[model samples]
Target: MGVFKLPWSLLKDINKVMRNFWWGQVEEERKIHWVSWKTMGKLKTAGGMGFRESHSFNLAMLAKQGWKLLHHPQALASLVLKAKYFPHSEFFQAKLGSKPSFIWRSIMDARELVKRGTRWRVGNGEAIKIWEDKWVPKLPYAKIMSPVRVLSPEAFVSILIDPGTKQWKTSMVEDLFLPEEATLIKQIPISFNNSPDKLIWSGCMAPVLKETSKMFLPKPTIKNLIKELEDSGGKELVEEFAVVARRDAAVDRIQCKIGIGLIIRDWNGRVVATSRKFRPLFPDPLLAEAMGAIEASCFGLQLGIKRIILEGDSKIVISAINNREENWSAMGMLIEDVKIKLNSYEEWSASHVRREGNQAAHKLARDALLHSISSVDMGIISHCIHDCN
Candidate 1:
């Protein structure tokens, strides 16, 4: 309210209205009811005041909201945050006496409930949380201040490619998250060809130390050093790079949408997956085929399954996945439909299954033709025919 500069009359009236309407309501409410103990150190339990302290109660609510935000690591806001602060310690906290920014403090306070009564990491899983987890201390968050391990690793770097950016990066340790600088090629140009030393053998040499007046040589601990490189921006930048680099050698991926209305499935020998009515939207041959591929991929991602098999009777759609012919312009993004997402999942695979074996997926397509659904209904079926190689 005070941030703006308005005419004297306007400002005066605004302030007057705020004070009379808003302030009056707040003052009146404060007097009406109180949800707190009477400033006593005793528990509100054990026959003490049954009222809840509004201050702590509000703080607890804020804390819960913060937990939700942190829980969704894949969300846009979360992605922005992890990019900011990562390779983090046991947990993050908002300290007393030293106040963080308004937004920061709000997020911290929103998750304050976890700070009280409940302890961090009661379970076995090592969650990237805002509190130091005591259960699995040595995992990611534990700060033991111990000596670094000097050992060789099995998988050093995996070339990764990000379809979104069309860029490449390298991963230091596969199956585990690594920091950015650890993944960057800070050294002079080194070729990856000729089966360059088995990842961990960063050139077999006894540990050497050469320290000058201003420089201290690091006895590089790939593991610990990677942990310290947690700044989220650096982590994502390097991860994206790795994704792109790995993608270069990957098999071509194709995308298209598949509607369930085109195929029928039977549970106990009766139609199970088809929609109730005929859908007029899927009038064209190309659209019907494109939607099939889309439906196949969505199911794969949702089921948390490894691979998907998409089988289509449409030769054009099936050929696109099997690499039989060129894609027509009518197939705009049809080729890009079931692909790209496979880049992130190391275990995931997809193939063009035979139309007979892909009965379940085909059922979804058949159902799509029945109902006038505007939904982009998608499902996944592993391309079991990839092994046909």
Candidate 2:
């Protein structure tokens, strides 16, 4: 399927074969499918095993091949394809002719997906056309918010930046864009360092890194989620003390530790008390995280903090607590225990944060590996506390 486009009939037959195998049936036998293939193909987070839908998967795979050909022009296969189909033109601008090979035609068909999923990251911005290219991050395809009738064929993104200060030329942007569009352009980061503009794949781009043109990208972490929320002006409302917990498991050593960190702030951004703690070793990281939440609850109670927001980097534990239902899994009992502790608080809520937001707790958890102590007072780690004036 990655090498060449499969016929619709062939894909259908393949899906049928897979469906039969899933239901424990032979080619000659028919059986009831307990679950629909559509349900089975849904992601695990959506309550189904993540199975590939054949048609979309095929298109995605082919689009990946097209992406490779465009990005890896120096590669042997890319070089060969370039010579054969696009000798006179670049990959992005390549045109279909009267007769092309089946493979080349299939590659062209997939190129549309690659085009839709990529945008240009402005840098020096010498090559990108103002109206023609996709560079606006918030808009679909990074396209201009409104059509520009007077844009010159050679007009570049560099025109929008001031040569003297390396900042956005606000007057020029105001002249070129609608009020809302101009506001969005101001939020985009510009570098005075004169780096070349880079192509960014939408699928692989992260808010932290801005853009990545790579074929394989890392999954978005909790850190990325937090950064995105912060960038979007969404984290401003969280003004109270939020307890963050991070857990670590040393599988080889059969040891686990949980670290707890607290941030108490007023609406004015004054920190009330910040502290870190390390709990004794537990059987597993999930247990450690659950225990950490219970420990944080106790810590808050002792402090006489009436309102608390419990945060942990462990999605499983946090989700279990938030679901407000009994979980019967291995950590279900522990999660239930944590829930009971949380309930003791006058006003409390449990949420998940990315490890980035919970770094203080993570550091404390890692530090626990060197100690044999079961628990320590917040007083001992007084140096870790920061009291804002």
Q: Pick the candidate with the highest lDDT.
A: 2
Candidate 2 at residue 64, lDDT? 82
TM-score of 1: 0.24
**Per-model TM-score versus the true fold:** 0.24, 0.53
Q: Which predicted model would earn the best TM-score?
A: 2
**Candidate 1 residue-wise lDDT at 191:** 19
Report, for all candidates in order, the number of backbone clashes.
Answer: 70, 1
Candidate 2: misplaced stretches above 4 Å? 25-29, 207-389
Root-mean-square deviation per candidate: 23.8, 18.7
Q: Can you write out model 1's per-residue Cα lDDT over 1-389, one digit (the tens) per residue?
A: 11122345764565445334433556445332222224332366665534333444455555554554444557776665445544242124424224444554565544435433232221111232212222111233221122223322321222322224322333322223333222221111121111121111111111122232122111223234345555443654333221100000001012112234322222122221222122222134544455445544443445454322334555544445444222223332344444444332333222344556544434434443333233322232223211211
> Which sections of candidate 1 miss by over 4 Å?
1-282, 324-328, 347-364, 373-389
Tell me model 1's lDDT, rounded to 2 decimals: 0.33
